[model samples]
Target chain A: MNSFQLLNGLTFAALLFVVASGFTLVFGLLRIVNLSHGALYLLGGYIGYSTATMTGSFGLGMLAAMLGVAAVGLVLDQGLLRFVRGQELRQVLLSLGVALVLNDVALVIWGGDSFTVPTPELLFGAVPVLDTFYPKYRLFVLGMGVLVFVLLWLLLNHTRLGALIRAGVDDPEMVEASGVNIRRVFVLTFLLGCALAGLGGVMGGAFLALYPSADAEILVFSLAVVVIGGRGSLVGAAIGAVMVGLLNTMGQVWFPELAYFVIFGPMAALLAFRPLGLLGRAV
Target chain B: MLQVEDIQAYYGEAHIVQGASLTVNAGEVVALLGRNGMGKTTLIRAIMGMAPPQLRSGRVRWQGQDLVGLKPHEIAARRIAIVPQGRRLFPSLTVVEHLTMVKSARATEGWTVERVFGLFPRLAERKGHRGNQLSGGERQMLAIGRALMLDPELILMDEPSEGLAPAMVQRVEEIVLDLKRTGLAILMVEQNLYSALTTADRIYVLETGRMVMETTGAAANADEAPLRRHLGI
Candidate 1:
């Protein structure tokens, strides 16, 4: 791939990392497949677009989108996920139902037309990179993705709270017996994961047009990222997203006829060799 | 000090521990001895507030406060730690991480990671090894070290010596004695009568979910017939 394509691939991978990281965290800690995560991402983009349009402030729109989706995540965890804990099938079914309802709700509110949040004026311009013009907003998204990764790594490895979370990821029962309030950890994880998805929605919406069915489309890609990265592994998710992002981007560039098959073929092959994905450990 | 007053615990509708009561004083080591399925674990579960052994009716008081409805984490925060049966270590975590995770609850000036390493030098050597990679004895040491990291005022050890080799059992006994010298109270449940009597200051014999006899370790060990009959040894 050319330097421009490589940079673009990296930028796309960064967004995928942010979105998939949360999915991995929830899956790793709670062992719950939160299907509504896609809906949260879609809702966040719509919220960001409307908020930015109303307030004429992109930053505020992103903030409002994050907080709103985080609140929604809290409600999902406390009001819905709590009741369906320990039953994987039930959680999937319930979350899928919620996702469908959320999609319809968004459609009713935002209508059928696609919407876009114009990139911030400062970041709207393009920067010269290796003789190719790269959108400044995409670079900003890449920077934010790296910042979030480092922050999350520090939070999970350095702090006492992070220790508790890591311990929960390893053995939740042991965490509970250690006198750490595991329920609070669960709620915090849920909110944090959803917040990341919301951020992804906003950034992604800015990059790609947002419509009512955007949730389903993003969900498929995010799920593919999670599967290739392995369940519950943040580093794995990041690595997997970069690999998949490169493959998907390069496939379209080099072999457009077999691009879709090329993207999923590696996932199928990886699963065949390691059912837990590239970095997943057997639970 | 701890007092379990007529605690009736059940697994669903099946009552496992019916009115079982016992006590452990500060710096003392007590043993809850019984045959399999005779409610020894049920009593421990009741005290720890673990599910299945629902505290149907009873009061578990430690330091003069009721522990009947407290969650397991609350019970641990209140200075009670349990080395559950089978040494339930986090299979993915290393020994060092296990100790570090629960270090928040460690008693000030007591049972630091250094101290735990001192107690179980084997764990120190295998600090980076995951739980599943360790032998049974090593896993047991890691479990003990994990509990010690909490710096609990009172520890409930369920079958710590179970399934360990004789050498490991001796090492565990020495550690128990050392913990007792440091003024940590312990309630141990054991199938190994000889090892239990060696470490425990007092013994509570259970039969079919009821406390049949309570005696000092010396007295119980002196009367081998009663010990053997109750334990089915």
Candidate 2:
């Protein structure tokens, strides 16, 4: 309704897009629901928190989170999920178990208390916007989101790897039969998706504190974004994130009692009309 | 050169390709002809190590090396490519993207994107069109062009003329002949009996997952009776 709410919606949507884009990609190419994505978020947040605290460099924390979380994702995919590659139900259950286990692991490491990444000194103030001032950090987050979108667009459009990913999304078997090492592509995609989730985790942790249940909350929001957007579409994920982010922020302000309903209502309506989602193809 | 020695592939428990065997010598176009559900496609997929029907027994050899346990891409890396049934073009990829997606790490002397474009001029004209947007004939051309991008020593084509017009079928035959002149081996599975007879140097008839007959294309074309009896056509 107001500028602050709009900014809040857009910034939150930016973070949601970062997380859900990765989620949707993994679903798109690797065909995994990857429920542990939230746990990866929480773990990355905790790792980033520690790194920032120890080294006093927010940049290091971001780098550490992305690399660390991607390593975990590599282990998850190559070690556990590879055995049950085509079994969707098994992957779901396995990733769910991993999520629960990682959630507890974070609990043991960071305890039940909430933690936040301190805003860097360079971004420690507010900037003036239309009719009001907004945190420079949030604006930076929005810029990062735009940068990611642009970079991904370029990668998918201009680069050979991007073409492979897009083609793999359409028909992976056909891509492989054309002499591409599709398994290598799958691993690269999973790593990139996990790394993005980690980056989103650090960014989200800075703005919204990270705690035990935060992982579940972020995971649910990401799942909503992916479902509304379509399983494997990048543009769909961005649009879906913005829609959900705006609705969520506006609903909490206008009608707190009906906030969840306000979000799910439109999503349910969209699903009833477009069962394959806005850009999804038949799986 | 490729050889399939007594491969038994199954879809879960349903045995689809039961003890089928065939071979394609270098520079030869071998056709596997059969009725619907006679496991022609299954044999092709089995050779490629695709699942369901899963390969339970036998060996697929390329250049004298066994390929039974290799991944589909690994098998493809051995200079073999598949133009699958239905074209299986990436519905989202444009014509040029399809050709470029095949990374040219192997023999650089073979087909390039430019060469493929030259080969299929229709594909060159509609270079920006997505796979789903192409006409059936154009889709077939693009599929063949995509396979050629790998510069494959051998190609596995499944029903290359399944739904083409008569003129398009003639175009496909010309392409097969053209590739053969370049010394490329091809293992084609086809439901269209006449199409196979035209492009194939040798033909094998499959009956209920078994190789019931093997004859030269010339012999089969000369006496269509035994081929017709085996094919039940």
Candidate 3:
């Protein structure tokens, strides 16, 4: 692939990583699918769009979106998933119901019209990366993605709280027996994951235009990224996103008819060979 | 340091521990002797606040505080640790990681990782091995080490020597005696009457979830009739 294409692919992969990382985190720790994660992302974008329109500041919009979706996530955790523990089918149905409700809610507020946040003037221009120019906003998204990845890595690996999280992931009963409140950990993890999704939604809206149906399409891609990356590993999610992103962009470029198969084909093969995605521990 | 006063525990509607009363003084090793199905493990579970064994009535007071409504972690945070039946080690974690994960929030001069390793050198040798990789003896040692990491005031050991070799059982006995010397209270539930009598300061014979007999160490060793009758030894 050309350098321009490569940079574009990397930028796309970075966005995917941002969204899928949270999906995987919630799935890994809580064993919750959180099908409404896409709705949360879409809600974040709408909140950001409205806030930015009102205040004329993208940064403030992002902050508002983060806080708004974090509250939504906490509500989902406490009101919904906490009561429906271990019932995967029920969670799926309920989350799908949440997605429908959120879509209707967005339609009532933002309507069916497409919308976009004007890229900040500071990040409006393109920067020459290799042989061609790359969007500065895309570069910012990539940079932010890496920064969050690093921060999350440090948080999950270096801190005492991180040790408890890891312990919970490995065996939650043992974690509870170890004198850490596993419920608090669950709530905190859910909020953190949702906040990431919300941030991704806002940034992604800028990258790709936002519409009501955007949640459904993005949810599919996010699920694909998570499955390909393995369920619980953050590093796996990032790597899987890059691999899928490259295949996605390149498949459309190189093989249009075979594009859809590219993502699932490799995943199926990987599962057949390793079962656990690359960098994922066996459950 | 621990008092279980006529505590009635149940699994669903089936009463498991029917008004079982027992006590373990500070620095004492008390054995709750019973057969496999006689609610020994159930009573321990009720005391630990684990589910399935619902505390129907009576009280489990530790240093005069009621333990009925507390969660398992809250109970553990109060300095009560359990080397549970089946040595419930996290199978993915190494012995060292298992111990390190549960390191006490409140530091105590009595027990440290170093001291635990010193007590069970076999555990130190197998520190890097995952829970599933270790033999039964090694797993039991790791379980004890994991509990000791909490620096617990009272440890409930359920079948510590359940599936160990004779030598490993002897080593475990030594560890228990050493722990008693350091003034930590222990409540052990064991079917091995001889081993229980050898280490325990006092013994409570449980028959069908009720305490049938209580005796001192000397009396327990001297008399095997109760054990022979109840446990069919």
Q: Compared with the true structure, what per-residue lDDT tens digits does model 1 show for residues B1-233?
A: 79999988878889888898999999999998999999998898788877767887889999999988888899998989989899988875677878877875344576788888887788889988878899999998888888877779998999999999999899888988888999899999998888887998899899888998888988877887887877778
* lDDT order of candidates, top first: 2, 1, 3
Off by over 4 Å in 1: A1-4, A128-132, A250-260, B5-15, B36-38, B91-96, B105-141, B163-165, B207-213
Kept native contacts, fraction for each prediction: 0.65, 0.87, 0.46
Q: Which parts of model 2 are misplaced by more than 4 Å?
A: B104-108
Put down candidate 3 lDDT per residue, B1-233, tens digits, no spaces: 79999989889999889999999999999999888789999999888888878887999999999998799899999999999988878765667777777774344566677787887788888878878899988888888888887779899999998989999899889989988998999999998887898899999888898998888888767887766787778
Candidate 2: count of backbone clashes, pairs at least 3 residues apart or interchain: 1
Could you give candidate 3's per-residue lDDT for residues A1-283 as a string of tens digits? 7877787778788888888999998888888888898999999999988888888898988888888999999888788787788788888888899889988999999999999976678998898887888889989988988988899888876566666676677778767877778889888988988998888888888888799889987787788888878887888889888988888878777888998787778878888877767766665
Question: What is each model's TM-score for chain A?
Answer: 0.96, 0.98, 0.96
DockQ of each: 0.59, 0.79, 0.49
Going through the candidates in order, what is chain B's TM-score?
0.95, 0.96, 0.95
Compare the candidates by TM-score and give the number of the best one. 2
Candidate 2: tens digits of C-alpha lDDT, residues A1-283: 9999899999999999999999999999889999999989888888899999999999999999999999999999989999998899999999999999999989998899988998799998899999889999999999888888888888878888888999988888888888888889999999999998898889999999999989888898898899999998999899989999999998999999999888889899999999877888884
Ten consecutive residues with minimal summed lDDT in candidate 1 chain A?
A157-166
Q: Which stretches of candidate 3 lie over 4 Å from their true place?
A: A53-57, A272-283, B6-15, B91-142, B163-165, B206-213
Candidate 1 lDDT score at position B96? 82
Docking class of 3: acceptable
Q: DockQ score of candidate 1?
A: 0.59
Docking quality level of the chain pair in candidate 1: medium
